[model samples]
Target: RMELLEAFKTYFQQGVANPPGNYTSYIIKAENISRLQKLAELLTKNHIKFAFGGNQNARGFNYDRQKEESFSVGRNDLIVNLHQPAAVLADVLLEPKTLVSDTNTYDITAWALPYVYGLNAYASKENLKGLYPSLDLSMDQDAKTNATQLPLAWAFSWGSTENAKLLIALQQANIKVRQANAPFTIDKNDYPAGTLLVMRAENERLDKELAKTISKIATSQDGIFKTISTGFVDKGKDFGSDGYPLLTSAKVAIVFGDEVSSLGFGEVRFYLEHDLNLHPTIISVQNINSIDNAQVNTLILPSGDYKDDIKEGLAAWVKRGGRLVLIEEAINGVIGKKGFDIKKRDTTTKKDDQKENFGSFANKSKSNFDDAIPGAIYKINLDATHPISYGIGNTYYGLKTDDLIYKPFVQGWNIGEINNKSLMAGVVGKAVRKSLDAGLLIGSQDLGRGQVVYLATDPLFRNFWEIGKTLFNNVIFCDY
Candidate 1:
């Protein structure tokens, strides 16, 4: 308060002594006029000489004619509306990244994203005539799609009994079905019950490891055979005839499961088929327990939804030096009983008490951009410089304490201590046990012969496609 008072006194004395010339535009908001009044008091009390407009333009305070008047201050004066022209507020809040002559190029989606999108929204439309006039409408478009519909199981034979039921419903609806490896093992005499089988490319230019998987599938008695992968596309001439019918026309198709595809796999498909000039033949699998016949370069599990078999596979894979990406939910669900334990109190089972385990639907989805949440983004102090944050801002993101049910993973990430509880901004904690010296959130740990990069947030291109697209590219695609 004293500091602000002193600043006002300084400005007030200066303004009163010179009476602010017409060359300067003294803009003020309605709510902030009180500050101006305080400053006026100081000037009057000190009896300092001042002016309102300049000597040449005595009536008009020579503000730039090009700049539009944001408030109803009229003619010579200008008003700045905080809510209406928030971009101007942000412009004054965040310092723009300085241009460098070195290799440090600015990332479009990483460093200058959310703020850019936010400011662009709050900027007056008329004021932004030439700057991205096309996206003016996108600010009002509804981007939220309800995830109410239960995903149909096109290849139910590969999943559990519940999966089978889902597949049957889709089939009855005339949805195309495909069969892959079953989540559970069946008797050798068991028949193929799936709707369709999607053949994956065994030896595409990028997937050289698929040859052994294809050979294994051929020798197996699962009868869950698939056609040649459309990923092979023209490389395999018999797509319509011998290629995976699911890729071409099956109303319901079963592809491989992966952590990267947990949210929207359609974008990758679009990119592959259109942007990258390649066909996408893989399917995203939530549970990896059924994929024994295929060989994968990396096996990913997005936190809490893991099975015993999947864990076993992951353990073996990690031991054998394969890549694995595990989200926070998976770590809490499978590995240890440490972090936020949503498991059970004493002894509780679903059959014993229906209210005990309500499944994934019980938890509500937390909004990342909601301003109601305090500390939607926590400032992370990192170690020196790292690769993950090579091109990102000096600060990283954390969970907002304001979000319902979402809690932070770090101690210093909290906003305030209230009622004996620490209110933090970031959710989802990663388990770290290491002896080496490196950064925590954006650090890479050498596991066995391979490496594991631990990012607090799922920087997957799929999740933050809009705001952090370039950041994702730097982490996933860039060799640097």
Candidate 2:
């Protein structure tokens, strides 16, 4: 649970207006056996006895209240973390769903705490060093960011969610922030595009208070105010160039109601409130027309059907310089409508599927079952030259659940697209896989003064998908 919360922090999410969530959780961090033995030693010294499960000294869990009495436990379910994860994934992909159960299953069988919680993991073929003398569960102290002396400006590489949190913090503090649209080198250190610059000249009012304010922000969000001294770079845009665009804090709104996906809505809500220290307006599709762009400049629509009377108004609003963001199925509705050139990739084929398997009901049921995509990982080709893809790499791992595809983004900024629909993880069906092969996943165009951004998948999917979290908020923060 703490790790899950840490993941949120790593994404640089701070003061995000989070809906109160309460649940039972425990972190099983076994760095080494000695740590467990040390814990056992302490517990035993205090007259508390326990049994070690899943070890060489493995004994069935049975604990007694008295010193000599046998061990006892209440009803419980023990779930071991799936190590060497390839085998199960292969089974799900290769085998038919009916092989596991012909009847409709209660829910998706996949229960992964790691990816679901947005925790990072690496599958190592070799074991890591596991020697431990003691387990230090100590938290990090408030190491406030202190500078020896302020340079012409303070520079921060736009990497991690922490930098994102800092960017919003500086914006909120009225400290003039600028983002470099091109990669730069300063003090022999190279920083990529989207590097943040807080010019000392712009914020003369924050002369002495600048570092102090940054410290407060860091302490509050557990942020790392890691900065590089700003100077004339060897390559790329200079500090005084127009290549660096001034950035403003975002006034965000997430579309809520029966038409939207609650999961999608909640993820964005949690991210904005907790990660970026912003409380987004929770407006409904019913209030689409009523959305005063003055109050909420940025509107995000999570995956759902909203092509009613509201969608047209919403698209019109975008042309008026309102920042409009769409995720997954929501894009399905508004494609080829107004202010967007994205066309939905047809799921239907010339040869009728039903007609081919007309006599076979079982075959038809199997085919229908196979079409479902329960969060498959896809590799996207991102054109990082665009500001939307800033801080994000050339390739993005998109977790695609919906097979919502668009024709090649001939118009606007084709920031992200799937060339081959690279399935990195999870099971993808024959039909959906083919359609997902080559299409635009993320595209944006300037609609009038406003902009319309289309996302083929929700970047804030289940509050997992780390890059998506950054990319989702990028719509609000990114200059482009």
Candidate 3:
């Protein structure tokens, strides 16, 4: 058990360790913003060394827009978000390659660290069920066999083309291989449908050496193969087809300006460039007039302050049949300024002018752009039939950190909606106001021959919320 636990720990550490990068960022979401702030404080008090937004007085450093801090716990370069729920980016030492493989490393690490550290804090505070670290070791169960009489043949599923290369590499290394007559299943995972199994006859010395080599390759950073002791057999269940549909590349341009905040821009860029494998050109908002619409299919504007001219130019581009994707604060910039006018829902507390309490209530009616929801999970009703909702289900969960209270759209379709039950955190009691009433979460407006896609809250927020990735992808790939 100790050995297994230690291996698991090493596995997780390697999974999070930076991969040839200056800094490694981890996104963490808690039930509420307070819990996340507390975790940041705890890390600071413990001399863990971190940086965050909002609380500059904390033990760790505060995020400075100018400085380039390398990911180092010692240097106190970790980035945390306290004003809104965001993913935390910290420096992680790159573990030696021999220690652990990098297969699905970032995805696994993102999920694991939050569960280990962030969720633990929430679990302790709210008395919620804490997540326990686990590894699926069912493969070990199939390996129990007589040591000398171990099966010589190995089977691999046709899940990936890389497995074929593995077979060739083994043969070139002098491991004898022949095709087996039958297909087999191990641990309920069916092998290739073509009865394609590679066999190496059990020669005492050769088989033992081959086993060691196979084990080393399986656990190596480059290998994706998993081995079982079972020999090849005939007439086993097929593991399904290993094919993917070819997708056309869309030219995506993201608007970046000197005045724009890097928080949302950075996260959106990271997802598009790294996760989605889409190379989007970073178009300056100042250079909006210089863009050639023919070269760009989709233009994304991250939540940030924009000049009226930039908005006017983008609005013109949308009218020329270009697809514009607006996120968070960007929604306000385009609305009313351009042909799109989405009025803010009246969330003001009613004030009786004749009453003595009017003075206090009048002060609260002022429009506050800083209004936010903060660390809440809201269910988004997706119109799957819409081009933007392609490949997505009927409903999806959106992390609503910002409250975009817009009046009913005068034109276009509401692709996504947030219902009353969608509220999960941040707002409570009377503070919830009329904003919680069924409101538009996502909508598209037709502008001449083009379209404007508006998302109320960030879907690829911090790149931690994996549920909304498809929705974001659809936005990138959808034909306007």
Best candidate according to TM-score: 2
Q: Write the per-residue lDDT of candidate 3 for residues 131-186, one digit (tens) a residue.
A: 22222224433442222234544443221112333443554455543332223556
A best-first ranking of the candidates according to their TM-score comes to 2, 3, 1
CA lDDT, candidate 1, residue 63: 18
Clash number by candidate, in order: 31, 12, 4
**Candidate 1 Cα outliers beyond 4 Å, as residue runs:** 1-295, 307-309, 319-321, 337-375, 398-443, 460-467, 478-480
Q: After superposition, how far is residue 108 of candidate 2 from its true place, in Å?
A: 5.9
RMSD of 1: 23.6
Best by lDDT: 2
lDDT against the true structure, each candidate = 0.29, 0.61, 0.49
Kindly indicate the candidate among 2 and 3 with the higher TM-score. Answer: 2
What's the true lDDT of residue 417 in model 3? 80
Query: For model 2, what is the alpha-carbon lDDT of residue 296?
Result: 82
TM-score of candidate 2 on Cα atoms, chains taken together = 0.71
Ranking by lDDT: 2, 3, 1
Q: Identify the runs in model 2 with alpha carbons over 4 angstroms from their true place.
A: 1-124, 130-148, 206-208, 225-230, 352-355, 362-364
lDDT of 1 by residue, 1-480 (tens): 999999867764554343221222223211212222333343345442222211121122111122333433312112222222122322232222212232212222122222211111112222211211011212112211111111111111221112223333333433443332111122222222122332233223343444343333323322222222122222222223432224112111123344433443454344334432334335355444333323543444443344333445444544454444444344334334222212211222236433443446433332222122222233334332233332233433332222122222242222111111221122221111011012233333444543333333443333322213323322332121
Candidate 1: lDDT over CA atoms?
A: 0.29
Candidate 2 on 245-291: residue-level lDDT in tens? 89867888989999998888888889888866688888978988667
- Judge candidate 2 at residue 26 and give its lDDT: 16
